[model samples]
Target: MGAVLAKSSSFLFILAAGYLLKRFGVFGKKDYAVLSKVVLNLTLPAAVITNFAAMEWSAQLLLIPVLAFLLNWLMMGVGLLASRRQAAPTRALFVLNCPGYNIGAFALPFVQSFLGPQAVVGACLFDVGNAIMCTGGSYAFTSAWLRAGGQRLSVRDAARRLFSSVPFDTYLAMLVLVVAGVAIPQGAVDFISPIAAANPFVAMLMVGMMFEVDLKPGYLRQMGLVLALRLGSAVLLAVAMYQLLPFSLPIRQVLAVMVFAPASVIAPAFTVKCGGDAGLAGCLNSLTILAGILGMLCTILVLGVA
Candidate 1:
C-alpha cells in the first residue's frame, strides 16, 4: 500500500509541478502543445511498440481489446442520449468528454505493481482497443457528427484520421505483428526502451501543463452528470466482466479494474476542439481520475484481487 501511494504521489507531483511551472512563467501557456506532440507522436508510440514486442501471442486475450472498444462506443452513445435535446455542440461536448480510458500512463502502472504479470498483459491488450478510440476514433466520430471537418463520417475519413495518428498506427502495426506471430527485433526493442520509459513522465507533464480548473455556471452540474454516468457504467461493466465472463481470476480482475480507468488523457483537447468548455473539461477529467482511483480501490477489495 505504501509503495502504491508513493508511486501515485510521484505522478501527481509531476502533474502539479507542470501546472505550477506554467503559472510561474517557467512554461508558456501554449507550451503544453509542444509536449503534447512529443507525447502523442513519439513517446507514446515508442511505448506501444515496446509493449507489443514484449507480448507472446494469446488468442484468448483478444477479448480484452474488444471489451474496451465496445465500452467507448457505449459511453459515447450514452452521452449522446443524455443530451439529446441539446445543440450539436452540447451533444458533441457530452459525447467527447464521456468515454475513453486513461489506461496507459495511469492504470497500467498500478496493474503492473499489484496484479501480477498476466494481468499486465491483460491491461496492455485492453489499451489496444482503448488507443483506437482515444487516439482518433472518438474524435473522428464527433467531427463527422458535427461536420466540423467538412468530411462526413465516411469510412475513408475515419480510416484516414486513424492512420494519421502515430500512436494509433503504431498500435495497428503492432497488432498485425502479434497476430502474424512475428517478433520485433531485439535491437529495435532496445532502441525504444529508453524512449518508452519516458512516456509516463512526459504524458503526465503534458497533462499538467494543460490542466485548468476554472469553475463557471453549470460547471458542476455538467461535470457531476458526466462523472456519475461514467462511474455508474464502470460499476455495471465491472460486475458483468467479473461475473459473466469466462476467464481466469487474473484476467477477470484486470477487466473489472480496467473499467474504472479515468477519462482519456487527450479528452480535454478533443472536447475543446468539439466546442466544449476547456476549463470544465479539465476539471471533469481531473475529477474522474480521483473517482477512478477510489472506484478501482473498491473493485480490488470487492474482487479480492491478489
Candidate 2:
C-alpha cells in the first residue's frame, strides 16, 4: 500500500512538472503539440508492442476486445442519459470522456505490484482492445456529433481528421507486429522504454498546466456529478462481472477495479482536437483522476489482488 501510494505520487509530480513547464513557456504550446504527437504516435505504439509481445494470449484475451468495447459503450450510455438535460457541449464531454481509463500506465503499475508480472500481460491484452476503441470509437462519436450539430462533414475529411488526432494506427501497427510474431529489435525496446516511462508523467504535467486555466466555477461544479456517476458505474459493473462472468475471479476483479480508474489522460487532447471545449474537458479529466484515486484504493483494499 505504501509502495502504491508512492508510485502514484510520482505520477502526480510529473504531471505537476508538465503544468509548470507549460505555464512558464519552457515548452511552448507548439512544442507540446509536437511532443504529444511523438509520444502518442511513436513512443506509445512502441510501448504497446513491447508490452503485448510479453503476453501469451488465449481465448480469454481475444474476448478482451469485445469486453472493452462493451464497457465503453455501456459507460457512454450512462453518460449520455445523465447529461441529456444538459447542453450539447456538456453531453459531448460526457460521451467523449466515458471510455477513458489510463489502464496502460496507471492500472498496470498497481496490478503488477499486487498481482505480479502476469498481471502486466493481462493488462496489455486489455489495453490493445482499449487502444482500438479509443481510436475508432472516439472518432466516430465525435465526428457524428459534430456533423449532427451542423458542423461540416466529409467522409474523407473525417477519415483524415481521425487519423491525424491520435496514435491508434501506430498502436495497431505495433499490435500487428507482435501478433505476427515479428521480433521488436532489442535496441528499439531499450530506446522507447524511457519514453514509455514518461507517458504518465507527461500526462500529469499537462493536467497541472490545465489547472492554471481560468473557468467559471459553475462549469467546474458538474465534475462532482461526473465523478460520482463514473465511479458508481464502475463499481457496479465490477461486482456484477465478478459474480456472473465465466472468466476467472481474478480477471473479473482486475477488470472491474480498472473500470474505476481515472478518465484517460489523453481525453482532453482528443476533445480539444474535435472542436470540443478543451478547458472543460480538462477540468473533468482532473476531477476524475482525483476521484479515481479513492475508487482504486477502495478496490485494492477490498479485493486484495489474487
Candidate 3:
C-alpha cells in the first residue's frame, strides 16, 4: 500500500511541478514542445520498445488494439446520435470530442506507475489502434460525417498519419517482431531500459506543461454534453472489461483507468479542421484532463488496487 501510494504521488507531483514551473516561467508556454519531442521521439518509444519486446506474444494480445479502435468508432457514432438535431458544426464537435483517449501522454504513465512494465503491454497495444484514430482516423471519419467527403484521406494519407508518429511506428515494429516469434536481444532491451525508465516522469511533466484550463459561458453547454458522454462511455467500458474480460487484474485495472483518459490532445486542432469551434473543443479537452485524474483515482480505489 505504501509503495503504491508513493509511486502515484511521485508521478502526480511531477505533473504538478510541470504546471507550476510553466506558470513561474521556468518553462515557456511553448516549451512543452521540447518535452513533447523528447517524449514522443525518445522516452515514449523506448518505453514502447521495452514493454512490447518484453511481452510474450499471443493471438489474444491483438484483440486489445481492436477493442480500442472499435471503441473510438462507437463513440463517434454516439457523438453523431447525440447531436443529430443540432447544426453541422455542433454535430462535428460532438463527434470529434466524444472519442479519442490521450493515452501516450496522459494514461500510459498511470498504468506504468501502478501496474509496472509487463502490464504496460496491454496499454501499448491499446495505443496502436488509438494512435491510428487520434492521429487521423477520427479526422477522416468526421470529415465524412460533415459531408466533406472530398477531404477524405487516401489510404496513403492514412498510412502517413500512423507512420508519422515515432512511438506508434515503434509499436508496429515491436508487434511484428513478437508476432514473428523473433526474440529481441537481451542486450538491446538492456540498452534502452534507462531511456524507457524516464517515460513516466517525462510524460507526466509534458502533460502538465501542455495542460490548459479556459472555461467560458458558451463552452458550458457543449463541454458538459461532451464530458457526460465521455464519462458515461467510460463506465460502460470499465464495467464490461473489468467483469467480463479474462485479463489479469493489473491489465484489467489499467484498461478501466485508461477508458477514462482525457480527450486527445490534438482534438482541438481536429475540431477546427472539421469546421467545429476550437474554443469549445479546447475547453472540453481541458476539463476532461481534470476529469481523467478523478476518474483514474476513483477506479483504482473502487477496484481495491490502491
The TM-score leader among the candidates is 3
> lDDT order of candidates, best first?
3, 1, 2
- Candidate 1 segments whose C-alpha is farther than 4 A from its true place: 84-88, 104-121, 131-152, 248-250, 265-279, 293-306
After superposition on all CA atoms, how large is the RMSD of candidate 3? Answer: 1.8
Q: Give me the overall lDDT of model 3.
A: 0.84
Alpha-carbon error at 180 in model 3, in Å?
1.6
In the range 53-128, model 3's lDDT, one tens digit per residue, is 7666668778889889999999999999999888777887888889999988778878766775656888888889
Q: lDDT by residue for model 2 over 52-137, one digit each (tens)?
A: 55555445556765787678877778777887876666676777787667775456545544554334555555665575546546
Instruction: Work out the TM-score per prediction.
Output: 0.81, 0.74, 0.94
Q: Which residue pairs collide, candidate 3?
A: none
Candidate with maximal lDDT: 3
Report the Cα RMSD per candidate. 3.3, 4.2, 1.8
Clashes of 1: 0
User: Tens digit of lDDT per residue, candidate 1, span 1-306?
Assistant: 555556667777888999899999999989998987887777777877777776656788888889889889999999999988787766777798788988766676556546665676677778878877887789889987765432334567556765786766676687788889888899999998888778778877877787666667778888888889988989999999989988777889998999898898778877777777778888888888778878876787677663
lDDT of each: 0.78, 0.64, 0.84
- Candidate 2 all-Cα RMSD: 4.2
Worst 10-residue lDDT window for candidate 1 reads: 146-155
Number of the candidate with higher lDDT, 2 or 3: 3
